[model samples]
Target: MPLPKESHYTLADVLSWEEPDRVELIDGAPVMMAPPSRAHQEILTELTRQLANYLEGKQCRVYPAPFAVRLFERPGDRPEDVRTLVEPDISVVCDRDKLDEVGCKGAPDLIIEILSPSSLRHDRLTKYNLYQRAGVREYWIVDPSARSIQSFVLESGHYTAKDLGTPGDVLKVHVLDGCFIDLSKVFPEAGV
Candidate 1:
């Protein structure tokens, strides 16, 4: 396994460095993401738009990537100390402190990652653990190719996942009271 470089660099240092592509830190290790394809961008935009409509004037804020969300080991720690930085396809954060000029730097109340063939493994396994450990109340893994959404709720320090079928299936998100999203409306292809 490749380990993190011993040379400690601040978040500013990392951002200022001429990056060929977008990258995130996972336990101090760098993880690069493929530039989103058109399908991916369209799906993500729809999801963000739906959530924003539902959450408008509400406490929660829905955001789309390339917005960075830093999940640091310690609150108020320096940027260099930040080990996990991700730009989920979509995310909803109700915590004001997590919001900053750059982006959020902690777990959002809810996180949604739209999976592609390139990101399937990392999203299912690696990020599954990371988000759970970060204490995100709810996590949604939307697989456009599969036409399905996997809902995971953090329970007792672990995640409990449920398979939400196509359009008819209303995904009940525990974190958002009365907030249920019909997959068909969210994904145009999933519509009957």
Candidate 2:
């Protein structure tokens, strides 16, 4: 049965909200997001460009930040019942069913979060635990300041991570078989 428009919202209300400030909801609490820096946007651009290029004509698709992602959806759950809502720097979703007009219903196939000064702890700790608990297939924490990236793959209901410290390092996406991220191009400091 098709749900009535207002009765059920995957992210419709959140996306169409009048609030200009961006915030993420965790455990039903709103956490304000700081404005991103130019460096942050630049890194996001390179990463998004790489992912988008690889996903073209493929079943999977990529979405950049400002897209809503309601994680851990359960049967008969309303939008207000969802405990976590995040805006990852990049989201790659392979299952079309999880997607809706406003945002994604559950965990994306792969999630990438770029580090910012204000978001460091939130991304590394808070979101790390959330994504792991939600069974996110792959999670990446990109640290531009450190010129490193940590890739985590869900194995046996837990995340096992691999860190690529050098800017020239390349990481093959576990979920997307043929996809690889070349850090050299992702960071301007690479090959320095």
Number of clashing pairs, model 1? 1
Task: Score candidate 2 by TM-score against the native.
Answer: 0.88
Candidate 2 least-lDDT 10 residues? 1-10
Residue range 77-168, candidate 2, lDDT tens digits: 77657767899989999999899875888889999999999999999999999998988999999897887788999999899986564577
Clash pairs for candidate 2: none
lDDT of 1 by residue, 42-159 (tens): 7787778778888989989998988888866466687766666777888899988788887888788899998988889989999988999989889999888777788999999999
- Residue 139 of model 2 has an lDDT of 95
Candidate 2 global CA lDDT score = 0.82
Worst 10 residues of 1 by lDDT: 1-10
Instruction: For candidate 1, give the lDDT.
Output: 0.78
Looking at model 1, the pairs that clash are: 167-184
